[model samples]
Target: MKKIVSFTIMAVLIMGAAVMNGDYVSAASVDGLNDKINELEKKKDKIDEKQGKLSDKQKNTEEKMAKNKDKQAKVNNEINSIDQKLTKTRNKIQAKESEITETNQEIESLTGQIKSMKKKIENLKKEIKVLKERIEQREKLLKDRLRAIQSNGGSMRYIEVILGSQSFGDFISRSTAVNTIMDQDEDIMQTHMAEKREVQNKKSEVVNKKKQIEQKKKEVEQKKASLQNQKQDLESLTSKLNNQMSEKEQLMGELKEEHQKMEKYKMSVAEKQQALSDQAAVIAEAKEKASSEKERLKQLAEKREREAKQQKENSSSTSGSGSAAPSSSGGASTASSGGSGIFIWPASGSVSSGYGGRDLGYHYGIDLAPGYGAPVHAAASGVVTRSAVSSSYGNVIYIYHPQYDKSTVYAHLSSRSVSLGQSVSTGQTIGAVGNTGNSYGAHLHFEVHEGPWNYHSGINPFPYLP
Candidate 1:
């Protein structure tokens, strides 16, 4: 792309130079130079415009680059934050682990207490059974004693036993025996009843204690289940958080790559910009030199015009064409009619550059700014060797002159009027002025390539022209 730009500008420069060096020119010839001069002005304007556009584009590019960098930085920050979260989560996991350990210990402690309660419940059940048996035995003995009292006739049985005494002394002994027996029987019955009540109370106590232990067991089991669920929930949440962190890390990686690519792109753009600047310098230098050459040619034209005007006055009696070189262009005197190794102007245009490399890049041709659709003639008769659009030169035309061991390359032409392998004569129009592919503007970019590397044919066309 840069090469194309270089060629286009060179073509414009050559076109500008073409108008600056016409000998035997006059006001009449100004029409021909007018197009080229206008073209040069247009080129100057275009350069300014393009510079502005380029500046804007560069600014945008830089802004995009800065924004990308900032985005990458933000991504980095997010990654860091995620890392911190991961760290905190890990700590929480450790803490959770400790909590789990304590919960396990509690479960174990609860289990042991439950085991002890179970043993107590079992022992109480056995003690209650034993107490009930002992109470039943005491009640059975009291019932038998009551039965024996009833046999003696309940309340009257005691009196009848005392009255049935065999003698007075015998009766007294019988009565005493009956009273003592009844009292003893009553005492035994009361004691037995009391013992039975105590046994029932003891059984109730044991049953209540067993129920309390069972309730405690149920509570601990519920607590253990809850802790297990909590641990599972915590693990699941940790996994989700980890996944989020991983996603953030992946995002950070992508941002980093984009940032790196932008930096590399920035470097490349900067290098290309530098090259463009250098090329501009070279073009400026060429313009300065061409300007100097134009001044010299102009001075020479003025001197020749004065002499031609003198001669015209001397031949006042004959028909006058004014000057052979058309003094109308800048009022220059006519150029010499006959000269050795003379070549006619290939196209009517101002030369924008000389036959050497110019700035922006190695511009290998002189530029000629001709009128739109102007005829471009062959410098000398030769075979049309190459005619095509090139990657950098756009529409290009190449001619090979016989016996010169050299070739001329014309680039940035609008169209070619000749065919490859066709022979052309000197002064024959073989092409037209145009701005084609890779060309920034209209003009003819012309170059003379010498036989070999040591020849100026590719670098300079001055020595080859008359």
Candidate 2:
């Protein structure tokens, strides 16, 4: 009877020890889950901080882009104005050239006229010399006639000469000769006076014509000089305008380059923001799961403790309550299995192009034809690895599933609802599909990767989709 009583006590102690061991295991599990949840929460907070900085950067970049566009417009206007000025100046220069050409022709004609007038003056001088010689000869002849008349007692000589005739015919001839001598002397004086007057008129005409031609030439020369000055001014203006245009073009080029850089930077910030958002989402999901697990463990620990107490009490009375622990373990296994490796359709669309060779190059993703602004959802519960714009991709999103070692990409989105590092659930609306990047129309370019998300790391997404 003593041995039987000892065996009963030993069995009771063993049962008590097992109950305590089970309670310790449950409490430890709860503590571990709580610690994991705390770690995930911390990670989410860090991601949030990073996302805030990226958002600020994106805002600043957008502002810069706006200012750059404005500056570019202003530069373009200035360049256009400079071009107009250059055209006007060029036209003015051409007009001045025409005027100068006309003035030069006028100058040549005036020079020829001056030369002709000089030749005329020379001829007039020669004519005047011949007239003066004739006048001198005529004066000499008259003087001689006067001297002979005086030497022969003037009127008496004339009467003697007239009476010295041989017959009646001779007398008539002498009288005619005396009358012709007087008429000839009077004609010589009149001719000398007329020749002197003609010479004087010719000299006066030459002087006046020369003066007029010189004045005309002076005026024409002044006009040509004026035209030259105007042309020079126009040339200078054209040069200045060209310089201004060149400077404006250079500035515009620089501004364009800067604008491009800003766009790229803005895209990068957006991508970082998205990545952070996805990470935060993943952490939050993990925290939620850890919390749930902790609670479940706590409940299990309480249930086990109660059952242990009941078993101890029932052992004192009967023996059939040990099956409850294995049942609870099975329930925990079911819960754990419910939380992994599931995906859903990312968007509503028909596949327009499958992953393969394209016109330009190899297509890395499947193109989905959806109307603009169509809703895009997460393919699975995962962290957003990236969200941003690319020159080739436009707006895009990347979701990474750590559990499955898989990543999904959604490209050519018009707008995104979620940010970087955000956690997303399966079928959660993360963005809207639209024409973005190098796309021809509104569509979603979807990709799936078994490993890290990369351009070359993509596989055919059709096989993975439901």
Candidate 3:
């Protein structure tokens, strides 16, 4: 847009310079110069109004950028918090793993103990069975001896045997013999009862030991199961934390992109403000020149009127003709009537992509393929408002035409020859087309805007291009 601003101010300057140099100045022409000055002032007011709007936009952009920064910071903080939680959860999981390991070992040990107790219990059962069989046989023998005595005559038979001894010696021997037999029977019965009680006690002790081991083993297994459950819970928590962290990081990345876009927009606004300031300078100079010319013309006309009156008094019949008005050769170049159209094709190639939506997405401008390093030209005579490298457009130039109140862009160039604020004519080489920025191949991206170029403000160039 600086291009259009400079062009209009230059026209005003030219007019003022012409009036200052003319030898025969006229009052009417000087008044016309004043009128031009007023017009320039009006333009200045409009520029001020635009600048004010731009200022508000810049402020809004900055505010948005600040908001984005805050959002990014918050996301970062959330990610950090998730990281901390993940760390703690992982630590807990590790601890649970250790507990589970210990619990498994304890269960194994308890199981071994239970197996040993079971074997002991089986051995006790076998020993008790043998003892019971031996005791039963001994008891049967005792019962048989008792039945024989009962059939014979019970106590009477034993008494008769004792009395029927042949002599005193024989009686003693028979009595001793009877006593020996009875003592042997009593010893057998006592031994059987003791053996049965010992077997029963051993069996009971083994059974009690087996029960204790089994109970201990069961408790250990339950502990292991609980540990396993706790570990599972920790693992689940860790997974959730990881997912949250990923989401937060993604949000942070998006916020960073938004911040960068806002920065670019803010820069564009600043460039426009600078252009307006330059135009204001031009208008001030033009106004000064117009006022000076007006004063000079008024004095010169007064001097001429005096001379004419003196001449009329000297020659009563001779009436002088007023000075002829200055010729209308306004010493300024007129606006260019671009040969056949308002704009010239910026590159020598067919359009690779047209303006509007396409398969990949929206195409804001036409893409031209004119080969690598091919020269790219301006579409019209205008001032260069932007000549810089952009992440998306690469080596690009922006020019504004005051004649049509429009702007044009040339982008994706191998190199740029013009700088910001430079004047360019239609068909002038400002750069060379090549693969630059977000381009697929060596090509030029051209755009035409009905007014000053802003983001996504491009219109179809086909209507205006020759």
lDDT tens per residue, model 1, 1-466: 2112122233334434544565343433334334434544454454445556556766777888788778778877877887787688777778777777877787787777768877876876687677678768867877786797678777886677788889999998998888788787777678767766766776787678667767776776777687677768777877877887788777777777776666655554453344334334333443544445455545655776798878888778777545455423333222232323434567778887775445765667678888667888887765565566655566667665533535577777778888655667788888888887557668887777653111123645655665
Give the per-residue Cα lDDT of candidate 2 at 68: 95
TM-score of each: 0.42, 0.53, 0.68
Highest lDDT, which number? Answer: 3
lDDT of 2 by residue, 220-294 (tens): 988888888888888888888888888999999999999988987786676556555544555555565556656
Error of 2 at 205 (Å): 1.3
Which candidate leads the pack in TM-score? 3
Candidate 2: list runs displaced more than 4 Å.
1-33, 61-102, 122-160, 237-261, 285-384, 387-466
TM-score of 1: 0.42
| lDDT for 143 (candidate 2) | 86
Go through the candidates in order and give the clash count of each: 33, 21, 1
Between prediction 2 and prediction 3, the one with superior TM-score is 3
